[model samples]
Target: MTTPRKVTSLDVAKRAGVSRSAVSRVFTPGASVSDRTATKVREAANALGYRPNVLARAMLTGKSKIIGLVVAYLDNHFYPTVLELLSEALEREGYHVLVFMAAHTAHDIEDVVGQILDYQVDGLVLASVALSSDLANRCRASGVPVVLFNRKLEAEGELAVVSDNRSGGRMAADHLVSLGRTRIGHIAGWDGASTQRDREAGFVEGLHAAGLGMFAREVGDFRLPRAKAAARRMFDTSDRPDAVFVANDYMAFGVMDVLRAELGLRVPEDVAVVGFDDVPSAAWPAYDLTTIRQDAEAMVTITVSSLLAEIGGSNVTPPDPLPVRLVRRGTA
Candidate 1:
């Protein structure tokens, strides 16, 4: 085999008739170099097959240009939308995303955080962090800036961007109530997540606003089989609810399946239903689900942009909660 060709900063500096510092500054992000000097360095680099060493530059500047993204929402289609947007946005900002996935288990979150630390990422975006208070502290101690999106952690002082979950829930409740739905019920997501808690709170608050209370409710845990079980129990009641609001579209699909096939209930007539997250499947010909829509693309864009700002050594300003809306469809 032929020996690998080695290109170094010294070679570029010699060719450009400049110091090594000039070549280094030319490759460094946001570093200042004279236009003539930069042009010479570029020409010399191209001629010599010289490429900047990203790893060495990171060591020198203490910036990896890598942002770690932790997610716990693979089961929902909404998460994939977020991931796709984040990848594109981060790429544009010259920061690479190092994604780590955990499927709703809070138990292993610390370990995953540890893995992120090992990668020496400059910042972190928590898409669906199942973070305990202690785990949050651990991440803070690691000196990596964290920005939470879609899911908020219990620990205060963590930068977060989320939709107006409560408002979205209330809107759903009010819409169903306006349609003359009286016996209303709820399917809550997993108990631990702050997002799920806020949604449930908002739905309950909206019912109170409508001069009513929930006829029944169950914990769906934001999963399919568990949600189906919750739906089954609620529908099997002697006083079955006329309308139900499930926490997410993925779980809602399970609820609808059980209600139609097993319980033999006609949707929007026997029992109206609404859900959240507005996954593409929600508007499909078969489901046509009316649901709360949190703009996944916008959320991802904000998260990635924020992380890149931190990675670029800029002072990142926290953003306010994004708005969510209800997308109407045939199911309700």
Candidate 2:
């Protein structure tokens, strides 16, 4: 069988009795086009069964109209929320998102980013992951801007949008202390994560300021099973904590399940619990978890705007970390 030739923009322009540039501008997002010209082009395109070749246009215009997003994992409810918000926000600006998952290791992240660069994406966003200096430099050399969402780097000049985690930690600690819950324990996330380190540091600071010390500490590695195990170990002893501050809501749920279901303890009666990241599930009746709100909407807004700004050849100053607030519920 013989193959039919593919319809092209030139065919649409000829059929519309308009210049080829008119058809190009009509198809190009954000390009100037008169209403009459656009209508004619659309009608002609429909008759000819024509669509603009995005890859060819990208090669010519040097813009893929795509943003690459790298995330460590979406197991946490918070990340999925951020992803959805980010996709919506980017789509509003005529850009599409290309998502990739990578291990938390620097080498793995570097490999994932290298692959993203191969697609000629207009910009990059990293969530719950870090970018190596070498990879950062490579992205810069390629004129691809990067924005870190819900994460930060020790190295300066990298753009990031993160909640005030340290303050939130202190808020959790202060709340526990205000309730007269002494011997407060802490369940930490992956220590390598900046959120974990900052939250723990602030919690410890708050405890010291109140003339108290951490009664117990356990690392959960931000995994549900690990959090449950840590809870078991922390509460098994007779001299257990009366209150606990979990790093994030995802781990908080695991800890709560272990405490009530497995350990047969009444929440807030036997052990008051506080968590960070007021994720949607925190408000569920079953958990009713008190937590620090991370402002995912605000973070997503800043991330998309900052990335678009940098992509537009404008230098961007990293915004100050946004504030977090404590939300009281049955858990605490």
TM-score of each: 0.84, 0.94
TM-score, model 2 to reference: 0.94
lDDT per residue for candidate 2 within 1-332, as digits (tens), equals 98989998889989999999999999888899999999999999999889888778888799999999999989999999999999999999999999999988789999999899988899999998867877887888999998888778866689988988899999999999999999999999988788889999999999999999999999998889999999999997889999999999999999999999888999999999999999999999999999999999999999999999999999899999899999999988
Go through the candidates in order and give each one's C-alpha lDDT.
0.86, 0.93
What's the residue-level lDDT of 116 in candidate 1? 86
Weakest ten-residue segment in model 2 by summed lDDT? 148-157
Best by TM-score: 2
lDDT of 1 by residue, 1-332 (tens): 99987999999999999999999999998999999999999999999999998878888998878888888868788888888888888888788888898766678777888888987888888776677767767776777878888887645566688998989889989999999999999999888888888888899899999899998989988889999999889997668999999999999999999999999998989999999989888989889999999888888778777766655567776777789998999889
